[model samples]
Structure formats: C-alpha cells, structure tokens
Target: MAATKVLVVDDSLTMRALISGALERIPNVEVVGLADGAEEARALVERLRPDVMTLDVEMPGISGLQYLAELMEVRPMPVIMFSTRTAAGAQDTVEALRLGAIECFPKPKVAVPAELEKIIAKLGRCIKAAKGATLRKAASPASHAILPQIEWNGRVLAIGGDAASTKTIFDLLGSFPANCPPTIVVQHLNEDVAAAMVGKLDMKVAARVVMAEDGMAIEQGSIYYAPPGEAHLVVDGSVPPRLRLLSRDPVAGARPSISVLFASLARSVGADTVGLRLNEGDDGTSGLDAMATSDGYCIKPNPAGGFELSKKTMTQAIIEPELARMVLKLCSR
Candidate 1:
C-alpha cells in the first residue's frame, strides 16, 4: 500500500520524536516533515503537502488557529488538532472543530512513547474520514408534493438533527402547506441551543415549534421536539398524537433520536408516518440504511444538498414519512 503521508507540527523536539515514532506503527504512513512552529509548518505543507496534519493548538510565533485559517484559505487538507483536555484547552479544541478541523484529540503532557503509537494509528483513521467528510449543502425549497386533493387528514412527520442539521431540516419541511400535516421533531441538542436554533427556523406555514413535554397532546397548529438532555419525547396515538417521556439509551447515538422518534412514528402511525434524517456524522451504514428501510416513507437528504430520495421506493418525491402521510391522507378520505 502507498504510504499515507503526514506532517507532524509541534514546538518540542521530544514531541516531534514521539509523534514521529508513533506514525511509524501505522503500516504505510510516511512522516514527510517534522515542523517546529507555524512558519516552518507552512513551508513544509507547501512543499511536502502531506495527506494530513497533526497540529499543536499552542505553538510559538503564529498561533495555531491563525495558521489554520491561513492554511485552509491556501490549501485545504484534513487537519486534526492535538490538544490537552483542560477547560481552556477544551474550549480551543471545540473552536477548532467549529472552524473546520475534522476531529480533535487530547495531547499527552509528555508524549509517552507507548501511547503515542496508538494515537498515531487512530489519527490515521480519523484523517481518512475527514478527507471523505464531504459537507453537503442544504436542499432547495421543496415542491408542493402534498396533493391539494387531500389535505392534512391524520399523519405525523418527525424531524431531527444536531448543530449542522438545522438548515437542511427547515428547507425540507418548508414545503408543507399552511395546514401542513401534524409534525414532530426530536432534535438531539441542549435546551438553550435548541431554543436558539428554533428561533432561526421560521417555518413558512402555520407550524408552531416547541420543546416537547409529556402528555402534551399533539395539536394541529404546532410541532414538537425533544428538549435537550431531558426525557425522550414520543408520540402516543391519542388524538393528533400525544407526547410522552421515557428514560432510555440514546438510540442511534441520540437520546431523543430521529430514529427512535421516527421508529415510534413508524409504529404508531404505520403508513401515516414521515421522517427526515440530517446527520453530519457518518457513524455506520445502519442509521443510513434505517432511514431508508422503516415501514413508512423514509426521506434521506440527498448528496446534492438540494434533493432528497427514497431508497426503499422509487421516485425521490414519494420518500418515507411524507409518502406515509400521502397514503394516510388518502385513507382518511
């Protein structure tokens, strides 16, 4: 296998050596440059142009973030930040991730040769994923797929996502008419952040958004979602739908998961269910496939960013959840 090239950037000679030795364990990773600071690192990146960079957040002369901003503007490669996990350090790490570093890992105070090797191995995997981590754009305004012949009869549409998922979900759900289908959302996030996010999602129709609570009978005018690290919000087949709470393992990597909510919606509503998945992380094929296979119409965000498709059924327009609603409304008639 051709070597997966890497650039190790740190101020300490000991750190450089430790990082270098670690890279050797990964079968075909070649250490092209051992840079001392941002200046040297920049030159090395321009010349050697390694596949990935292990950057120290704290470096002399130019700060790591400044260097990162500059590097991204010039040559954007998968950059990983090796930082300590202190409160201050963690803050920097999170900021780096937001600024576009693929992933962030803690750095040992004194690089232990033993642990360093394992770090390098795992880092290689992360770098490969970052390279493939293609951030898709948001979908365009959806068409009026909900036929005018039959309106909101009786169906539930649920949506969910983390920080990156907001824009996409809003665009897809925006297509619903003024009297849109009764919808529920369980966005995996903190309460404050979720509220702040909702402020941005101004639905075109008369859809009211709120933090979901137990026994709150789903109404026609509003939409419900899980409120951060609270209880899991679910829909009971009451009138429109009743919201309930439960304590359980965060399914599909979320407490109030899109999967769990949609799974239940798939159960309660059956053919009257619609769901949308907008995950930024590609954890595994299961969640991706689940979004495709659930009994009800399952709509998956397309790679185009503007289009969505149904894997189980042909014709992207009639994907899961929405398609389920279409059938349910037909039945209600």
Candidate 2:
C-alpha cells in the first residue's frame, strides 16, 4: 500500500519535529509538510493535501478549534488535535471534537521521545478508526421522543438525534402510542450496538417501527428509522417527502445534525414544528437552544432531573406518551 500522507501543524518547531520524527519511524506513514500554524495549515492543506493532520490546540492567530471549524466548512479533512493536559485544554479539546475533529492527543511535558512516540501510535489508530466510522443522520419525524398523539391527522412527525442526543429522544418517546404520530429517526449508532437499540426502544413503545427508506410514506400508525452512518439526511418538498442523503461531512460531530433538521423543519412545517433535546455537551446545548428560540415549541432535558448517564439515572422522569397526548390535546385547543 502507498504511504499514508500526513501533515504536522504547530507553532512550536520542537513539537513539530518531535511529531514528525515519530511519524517517520512508523511504516507506511509519511510526513508531507510542516505547517507553522493554522494559516500555514490552510495553505498547505490546499497544496500538500495530506491524508491526516496533527493539529495543535493553541496557535498564533487562529486557535485549533477555530481552524478546525473553518477547515471543515471548506476543504474537509480528518484532524487530530494535539492538546495540553490542562483543564482548559481539555475543555477546548472537547470543543474540537464537537466541531468535527477525529480525536485529541494530550501533550504532556515528558522526559523522553519514547513517551511522545506512544502518543503518536495512539493518534494513528484514532485516525484509522475515524476514517472507517459512520456518522449520525437526522432522525425520522416519527422518532420524536415526545411524539405527538397517533392522530394520523394530516402531517407526519419526524425526529432525529446523535450520540449525545438520542437518549433524550428515547426519553421523549417512552410508551409511545401506536395510533399517535407517524415518526422517523436517523439516530447515529455504532455498527455493533445499532441493531440492538431499535428493539430496546421498540419493545417499550407502541408504534410498529422499522428502518427507514428513501421513498417511504408518512403513515398513521407506523414509524420508520434510518441508520445514518456517515452521510447527512434531509427531506425535500414532497407530498410527505422522501429522505434524501448527502455525502457531506458531520456537523458538531453529528451526521444527522439537529441543526440540519431544525432548519429543515422550520422551512417545512413552520410553527407546527416541535423540537427537544437533552444537553449532554455544548453541541446539544447550542442546538436545543437555537431550535427552541426559533418559533418552535422546544423542550430541553431538565438538568435538575439529575439524569446523568454514568450515575445510572434517567432524566426523563415523566413518560413521553402522556406528554405527547398532553401536547396533542393542547394543539387541538
């Protein structure tokens, strides 16, 4: 196989040389260019076109976070952030991940090059994993956690979520009524665990659920789901439009980005749209707030609910089916 081309971006010449040396030792991995900072990275990205980039969290003009966001918007590439092991650095690294970096590397002030070499090995694996991973998609309207009553009235209800947001959808759709709204979800799930999640959810809810298709119609009792791996999904203007797929990269570390759906729903259903999210990270916080503030009746998971995942607690203290019925009743009123 041809050598995997690499780019090392850092303001520190020592740091760049160390990273380059580590990569050089690795078989089939080639360091193509050394960028002084984000500006250089941008220019070199156009010229060298490296397979992967090792980005520093802090730089001269534009920070790594800012650079990554700009890079993703224009010519997208896989970026692994090399960050300091400080608390502030951790926060920025998380922000980088949310902004679409593959992963982060914590650069500690260590004694030997061997210590840094270990970090390089880990970085390489992360790059390889990201290149093969799938992205999240927009959840179907039917997958709304706080789904509407299965009235099958006139329009369809769609829902979508990513890794940090799908659990909120599950909470919002608990004990859903089969007769309620026709729903769909484009949840971002891993391959090994993806198949199991639909059933774990289906057994608790009333709707007969199935994976989604591009041409499926909006029905009264059934909801469909699309397994979004790495492409973004959107709905076109149709008599209940079909799910359209795109080769675009991720948004806020999400494939079926909530922003994409919320924007689409605002265009499609207008005031009829309702949205919700449980803030797991900054990505969730921003997305939920934007959607709610926009003329849609949006709900957020109450942090007061103490619904922490690691704590083995659920924040959805109330059943969503009842909430859905309540929402429907209010809409009729």
Candidate 3:
C-alpha cells in the first residue's frame, strides 16, 4: 500500500511537533507539512495536496471550525480535529464534526511519554480511517425559499449514520415538512457535537429539532437527536413513546449503539417505523436488520460523489432536494 500523506495544523509549536513526530513514527504514514493556523493550513493544503489533515479546533486567524466550513465547500478533503476537553472546546469540536470532519480527538493535557503513546495510537488510527473517507460538497435549499407542503404521515422515522453522513443528515432533515413524522436519529458523534448538529438541523428543517432527553414525549413535526459519547438513547415502547438515556457500557463499541435504538423501535412500533441507514457500516447494519425483522421498512441512500467502498456507499441522499422530495413521496404512501 502507498504511504498516507498528512498535514498537521495547530497554533501551538509544541503540539505540531508532538503530532508530527508521532505520525512519522507510524509505518506507511508520512507527515508532509505543518501549519500554525488556518491561513497557513489552507495554503499548505493547496500546495501539498496531502491525503488527510489534522486540525486544531481553535486557531489564531481563522478558527479551524471556520476553515473547515470553507474547505468542504471548495477543495474538500478528509479532516480530523484535535480539540481541547473544555466545554467551549467540546462545542467547537462538535461544530467541526457537523461541518464534515471525519473525527475528533481531545488534545492531550499532559505530554508524558505514556500519554503521548496513547495519543499517537489514536492519531494513527484516525489518520488511516480518514484517509479512506469520502467527501462531497454539501447541498441544501436556500433558507428563504418556500418549502412545499407534504401529506402528514403518522409513521415514525429513525436514522443511524456515522461521521461521513453529516451532510446526508442535514439534507434529509431539511426536506421534512412542518407536519413530518416524529423522527429519531442515532448518529455516532461526541455528545457535545451532537447538540450543535441538532441546532443546525433545526434551523434548516421545518421540523422542531432537539436533543433527546429521558421521558421526553415523542411528537409529530419534531425530531430528536440521540445523545452521543457514553450515553445511549432508547425509546420506551409505551403508549405515546418516551425517550430514555442509558449509561450502560458500549455495545459493538458504540455507546449510543444504533442497534440498541433500532431494536427498541422495532419492538415498539414494528411496521409503523421506517429505518434509514446512511453511510454506515456493519455496526449499524444489525440494527437495520432488527428493524427489518420486525416488519419495519428500510432504505439506504444511493451513493453519490465520494470514494466508493464495497462496505458503505456514499450519496447525497436527502441533501439533494429531489431525493428529499422522493423520500417524502415514498413515506407518505
């Protein structure tokens, strides 16, 4: 296999060096250039054309979050964020993920050798995984455009996706009408980032969007995003349907296991549920299977402008207004 080329971007000289040195030590991984901020990083990205980049969420001139938004629009490439663990940092990291970054890791607070080793392991893994990620320009309708009406369906919709599915998620949610079905989503992301995503989606979609809370009533024309990180969001199969947050250990390595939510919905609503699996792999497939077994309908978005993996196909899915239109047409039937 050819070596993976990486660009390291951060304001801290120490951080850049630590990340560069660690990445270079891994086999078949090469650190091509280093930039101290988004301005420098942008120039380097154009000049070097590195396979992947590690970005710091906070930067001097343009913040990493700002630059990522601009980058995904023009010269899209795989990006991973190195962020601080503070509350503000967590929020910015979440924004970055929503803006299409492939992964986010908390910056090491201490630079001990052991901690450095652990950071190195994480960076290496993220870099390789990101190298294989597919990116496409995001598509959505103008904020002021009039949205057409849709026949309200009482069927419930549940979606599960990974980091690569950010744009897909935005597109899907944006197409819903004010009377769209009660929707739930389990997207594998940091809890902090998940909240930001909910805010953004709410702004774009007619449906009211919010983070799922335990005991919150599921209502039509509203969407609930699953909490990420160590908590899994599940729905109690009771009349009127209530949300639950669990602190149990991760299943299949996902704390908010998609399978857990899918299984719960399968048992609860069965044929009344529609499961949409977008840009996810085997980890989410089992959940879709559970929904299918329970007589729920399942749909996978058609893959579009990204590198094709035999495992997961990439597509704009709901991002494109036409697909969004089609989704509503099918669901209303």
| Model number with the top TM-score | 3
Show the lowest summed lDDT stretch of 10 residues, model 3. 306-315
C-alpha TM-scores of all predictions: 0.58, 0.46, 0.83
| lDDT by candidate, in order shown | 0.62, 0.60, 0.76
* lDDT of each residue in 274-299, candidate 1, tens digit only: 56555545321243354446555555
| Ranked by TM-score, top first | 3, 1, 2
Judged by lDDT, which candidate is best?
3
TM-score of 1: 0.58
Give candidate 1's whole-model lDDT: 0.62
Task: Count clashing residue pairs per candidate.
Answer: 6, 29, 4
Off by over 4 Å in 2: 1-172, 282-294, 306-333
Clashing pairs in 3: 94-193, 303-314, 304-314, 304-315
Off by over 4 Å in 3: 111-122, 139-146, 229-231, 246-248, 301-323
Candidate 2 per-residue lDDT, tens place, 1-333, comes to 677788999888888888888878877788999998887788888898888888998887888877877877676677777877666665565456555666677775874587786566756665554443322322333445544454444444555554334434554555366675566565554432344556555665667776656556656567666555765655556766556666677778777565665556556655555554434333344544444454555554444442221111222343433445533542342
